[model samples]
Target: MESFGIVKAKKNNKIFVEFTRESACGESCESCSAKCAESEKELFEFPNTLSADVGDVVKIKTRDRSILSYKFIVYGIPLILFMFTITLSYYLMSKMFMKNIELMSLIMGIISLFISYLIIKGIDHKFQKTNKGDIFLEKM
Candidate 1:
């Protein structure tokens, strides 16, 4: 994907870029009375390959991302982890003749979901170090 953003700051070897986040509706407010289809902002860090300065508008491009894989990792993994944890916990609890098996399984499932978040974070950090979806930037 390609986008334009303004450089917000620089720290270490990373340049912080501020982008106006877009919505699925494309911020079309003409037909809507609420006028709530406004844009929000997002901050992203990129390698300062172009030596872009703060306040500069830059064009950014990214590659090496598969949307399907990303979706599965971010959404599917947590769901699968939660379901697996619930099933396993329930089975173990039942085998042990423990009371409140359902409640315990549910608690375990929720905990596993949080753990999945940590796992995803770790994977993201590692991939970032490797620059999986390497971004290229140039001053606009």
Candidate 2:
């Protein structure tokens, strides 16, 4: 993925850029004004290889594969785990306990969702350490 931003500061090889944050609601919702109240610009420090200077407009890019994997980890895995655990727990409860299967399955599904969150946190930590300098910058 690529985005354009203005460099706000420089320290060694790192450049701090300010870019507009994209709204998930697409700025079309009339019922909610909370998103509009939030700041639009977000700052990030990226390792600069392009010799970009403060006040320069630059293009930043991240690998598509990296983004895809991140999305899968953040959104996909937990959803699948939640549904799978619900069904599996219900089935097992029906066979073994034969009582309160619905309640038990709901509880198990929530537990599985929490476990998925922990797993995602661990994965995110590892990925951050290994992919610290994955972003690239180019002067625009």
Candidate 3:
């Protein structure tokens, strides 16, 4: 999964950053979605946070190949749906209900955002269930 985060703080020449790994449960099945999902097979996470300086743009490199597969389903699907919902709601509500397109679009956008939050939360909960100390950040 490609994730971006700004350095929140720096100490001892080590950068402290916060990044989100998608829920692991999403990868437990054939239809799981969540960029952070992984197969039930043991996942190895490094033990230490990556070393980087505050405000530095750093890339995280992982040898895991499953990230790509999860990204397409986990992130891509909702992104596409969000766009589709916004467009469709605008057009349909405008014609069918005589509502202003902009207003309807705004409402739909908010709805999409809420849905996204729910999805992420669901993933988080699932990931927490597997509570393994192996997940870690490495600076690259």
For lDDT, the strongest prediction is: 2
In model 2, how large is the Cα lDDT of residue 129?
87
Of the candidates numbered 1 and 3, which has the greater TM-score value?
A: 1
TM-score of 2: 0.74
Candidate 3 lDDT over residue span 10-95, tens digit each: 76555555555556454445464554554232222222355556664444443344455446647876787788888888888877
List, residue by residue over 33-95, the lDDT tens digit for candidate 1: 766677789999887877888999998776636545667899999999999999999999999
Off by over 4 Å in 2: 10-13, 23-39, 48-52
Q: Which residue pairs clash in candidate 1? A: none
Ranking by lDDT: 2, 1, 3
Model 1, residue 29: distance off in Å is 4.8
Candidate 3 deviant stretches above 4 angstroms:
1-63, 69-74, 130-140
- The predicted structure with the larger lDDT, 2 or 3, is 2
TM-score of each: 0.78, 0.74, 0.42
Model 2 clashing residue pairs (backbone): none
| lDDT for each residue of candidate 2 in 1-140, tens digit (9 for 90 to 100) | 78889999999899899998767655556678575634389999887777889999998889998888899999999999999999998988788967888988999999999999999999989987898656777899
